[model samples]
Target: MRLLRVELSRFFSRRAVAMLLLAAALLTALVAGTTIWGTRPVDAAEQARAEARVQAITSSPEYKRDLANCQESPEDLFGPGADAADCRRLLAPSTADVVGRVPLALADEVDDSGIAVIVIVTVLMIVAGTTFAGADWASGSMSNQMLFEPRRQRVWWAKAGAALVGTGVAAAVLIAAFWVALYLVADARGIGTGAAVQTDIRWMVARGVSLAALAGFGGYALTMLLRHTVGTLAVLFVYAAGGEALISLLPVERSGQYSPAENVFAWIRDGGRVFDSSIDCPVSSAGCDQTFQLTLLHGGAYLAVLVLLVTVVSAVLFQRRDIP
Candidate 1:
């Protein structure tokens, strides 16, 4: 209990930690505000003005001729018999197609807000976990901690457990707070309420918290093994930014199975856009179409393997190494 309280006090005393929490809150508000305002439905007057402008273009004689010519050869961009003037005909908005394409949820708004929250929460958790563990070793605090505890493995587990629980609680609170703010903003903007929308919001919050926990654990493990803040941060930054970007550039087919990035990206689904996948295929590939159902299973398995390997290796290293 004494050790736990001491750790908690030290964690909260850091200015950087406080700043990160504040930043997450501010970012959540900003993203939610933008999403709600930007995607609000146009008023009838605004729609009418747009319609008038479209009518002016489509009612022209050139537009009529163009429509007639297009009817004869719909796919051809230009040909010997093509009427150049008619080719510029303004298209009438097809109600059928518009209605058919209407998404079940407001994707732009949800994604804009949801993705920002996820990223901020995840990054903060990772940074906190890494620095908390690594700082002890870097500053020679671990020697004292271990000396006090005597049981090296217990000391290690205590730190890891505290980090996991603390970060997880912080993530949950932030995510829930963000979700409530978003819902209120969305309601104010008169976005239609539905069970589906509520479900999506819940799912987003849940996933954000889960991902944050995963990132925190992963960072903690890395810090334990590396025993240096600089090294841990370097490796994490490389994996999170450079590694993912490089993997994205590879041929779609080759990347799906081999890229670690793909393994982590399979949990987000806002409306029709699926954010995360467990399948080992490029997101844009035909393979995704065929293997969509298998994504969650594959992704879970992969993440489990990675977490197990990293945790075991880090534990072994920490147990064997002398504190500097």
Candidate 2:
């Protein structure tokens, strides 16, 4: 407990970690601000201008000619069972379509801006974890710290615990603040979110927090194993980018199932679909289908296995390997 407390202090005290956390917070705020600004309620003047534009378009001679043509043979324009009313309704552009300033919708944001913020935070946390661990090795402080606490495993775990806990708490706070700010804006604008949508948002936040924390933990473990910041980052980059491409070359069916990005998004979104072109269709090209459903369980399990393998190997190696 004492060692963990000390390591936790070190984790927070690091300059890189502090900057990364600040960056995450700034990014969250930026995303929230952008979403709110982009989706601000359409003003009266804007609405009137949009209505005028629509009226102008509908009143044009070209529009009249097209409408008349469509009314003559609605089946040619909109397939069978269409009429003059259908032409009038479908041909005219609405004010909303012209204005294009949609009101803030929390449910839609969950799938769009919410995922973006989560991804940003997760990437920053990964860097935070890597730098925190890498600093000790780079400065040759790990050897000195071991002298005070000779048990290597205890020291390793204390550092790991600090990295995990600190990153997890920071992620939770940032992600929650993001949603809370947006929710308040939505409330002030009189845009109500249903109980079901709120529930979904909460669950998504929970999953996002977990994924970010684990990503940080994985970064720390990988750095510990490699003992160099750039080496760990390079490995992660290759695995993230090259691994997906390599998997595609394999003859395995549903090769996208092995992609880290796919599983990560699936875990964050609760579930997702993957399309693999490598899947050999049994019949003609017309009969080919490549899309496959990826469940939350599969994503969770895949991520857990990856983190577990890296952590176990890192811990085992740190126990026996010489630290410089």
TM-score of each: 0.74, 0.97
As a whole number from 0 to 100, the lDDT of residue 177 in candidate 1 is 79
**Tens digit of lDDT per residue, candidate 2, span 15-124?**
98999999999999999999999989888999899989999999999999999999999989898888889999998999889988789999999999999999999999
Give model 1's clash tally: 10
Best by lDDT: 2
lDDT score, candidate 2:
0.93
Question: Would you list the clashing residue pairs of candidate 1?
Answer: 66-86, 256-280, 256-281, 257-280, 265-276, 265-277, 266-276, 266-277, 267-276, 268-275
Please provide, for model 1 over 128-246, each residue's C-alpha lDDT reduced to its tens digit, 9 standing for 90 to 100: 88878877877788888877798877777777776777677788988887777656655676666578767777787777787787777778888899887779889877876887777
Which predicted model would earn the best TM-score?
Answer: 2
Off by over 4 Å in 1: 43-52, 59-65, 71-90, 93-112, 240-255, 269-294
Candidate 2 displacement at residue 10 in angstroms: 0.7
